[model samples]
Target: MRRPRPIAPAAGQESVWDYPRPPRVEPVTERVTIRLGGDLIADTRRAVRVLETSHPPVYYLPIADFVRGALVEADGASFCEFKGAARYFDVRNGGTVRRGAAWNYPNPTPGFEALTDRIAVYAASMDECTVGDEIATPQPGGFYGGWVTSSVVGPFKGDPGSLGW
Candidate 1:
């Protein structure tokens, strides 16, 4: 399939098209925050991001940053060709519950070991997810967990008819 030309990135912006195909992992120092059901569920400055072509960065936070008792294991699993199998978690705070709102790779594929036990939440499923000063917009489609910020540009994948790209 012929991929569409990437949108030109303005200064200070990164085009998702520029990301690699196999994905790359890198540490991020920006503060990441996740709030669900009107409660702060996770916050951390120590995070990592997975960057892949046509997708926004997915931020993974250390398990220690989550509010105690907020993440309850849920009954579901998903597989990633690059990251290995992932387990789901329901985020509960106060009386609010978001079913299967987060996930973690317990045994990530080699080279992705940094992700093991680090949880990444679905930005769309949370009340708010932010990186630094920008609030995130969740990547389109429910299957992927990428958080779009102002610094990223895209003709991103996951929209209707985007599968062939």
Candidate 2:
């Protein structure tokens, strides 16, 4: 005879039980400095807080924080379901440096409106940047900046799941 699979003792049983749920999530904001050409390009005095489930806190800085004259508008734009629309910029340092390497949200969704007028530049475009005392490195790839350490999360720009740089 063939053996049948055994069922659990509590099959179809329903009962009220007390259990602790996960903690509520909140955004974390911090001040930072982006350095380029031996000068501080951006000083993030006030920026939006970011808290993804698997990622660390990222502060979204405003474009105005950067020296506007230092950045030239690039010929590119992207749409995001969450943040709304984004425009790109080329880091102008002597020559037409990195192209479309940085981006920002001119107008963002109400939930993310705090990022509006904020520019998140390509970390690679600059010589260096710093969050407090810790120096920030270029995020990787030809463009894009998730703004975290490579060891934590890495080389995500040119992945198959992502579009062209």
Candidate 3:
């Protein structure tokens, strides 16, 4: 692994800082399982089967896989062009609640309506979660689900940033 270094500006000359990150888009579709409070929170009962000719599929899991009654319904919502509108939830543990930390498509578009009852939440707030056999630790710091191994013009921490120069 290569370490990042900071460069100082040369005297009286314009200096620019650029971090050249290779545009990575791995076509990943492996089974994963997540655990919270010692109970499996989510599992891929089926592979994330999507095609090169179609939009990707994110198969969320039912609440059964998680610790019983650990999630509280939140007031957050979002819209997707290909997956319709989504609802959100807050994860509760020991009187601490992570606000609006997860979201899921309730009534998705016709192309992805199969995830109507499934939920996809942030993998950071949980006590623990897994993707495949890898038990993912809390992300460095972000709100979006980092479980999906794809990129969309990052530095993406907040809302999707500018795409045009």
Candidate 4:
């Protein structure tokens, strides 16, 4: 199978190809906002982003930034090779409820300690999600929580026929 070439990044853009294979965690100073249903549930400048090759960055917001009682543990869990066990959360705002809308690693694996207890929401599960001034488009598949922005270029993973990437 022929490998897809990544798009060339413009002057201010970044190619996901340059992101590392094991992923890297870095602090993001840009504002991150999340709205569920019709309510603003999270707004924070203190966030971390995990970047990996062929995938958009997944932003993790500190749980302290969420509204009181806005999140409740939902009944499902998953495991990641790098991040360890992840627990799901249902976000409740006003009268709207989005089940399994967010996830977090309670105890991340050795190199991913920055992810512990920080929540990463699925942008598709929210009414709106933004990073800095740009609204984020959810990564192509439902299973991966990556936020795609104009500054990033991709032949991104998670789209149909991209699993082999």
Better of 1 and 3 by lDDT: 1
lDDT tens digits, residue span 1-165, model 1: 777777899999999999997999999988999998787888999999999999999999999999999899999999999999999999889988889989999999998999987999889889999999789999998888999998999888887778888
Model 2 residue runs over 4 Å out of place are 1-29, 54-58, 94-96, 140-144, 149-165
Clashing pairs in 3: 32-132
The clash numbers for all candidates, in the given order, read: 0, 3, 1, 0
Candidate 4, residue 29: CA error in Å? 1.3
Candidate 1 stretches greater than 4 Å from native: none
TM-score of 1: 0.96
Q: What does candidate 4's lDDT look like per residue over 1-165, in tens digits?
A: 566788999999999989997999999989999998687899999999999988999999999999998899999999987778999999989888989989999999998999987999999989999999999999998888999999899988987789777
Model 4: what TM-score?
0.96
Cα RMSD to the true fold for all candidates = 1.0, 11.9, 10.6, 1.0
Question: Over the stretch 1-165, how does candidate 3's per-residue lDDT look in tens digits?
Answer: 222232343553211123122211222355657555555555665423222111122235655554566677889688755567888888665565678866677677666654656666666666665545555543224643644233111232232331221
Q: For candidate 2, lDDT tens digit of each residue in 1-165?
A: 222222222533211111112211233344677776777677866765444422223456767777767678889899876678889887765544667767777887667766776667666667776665667665344444545542234223333443532
Candidate 4 structure lDDT: 0.92
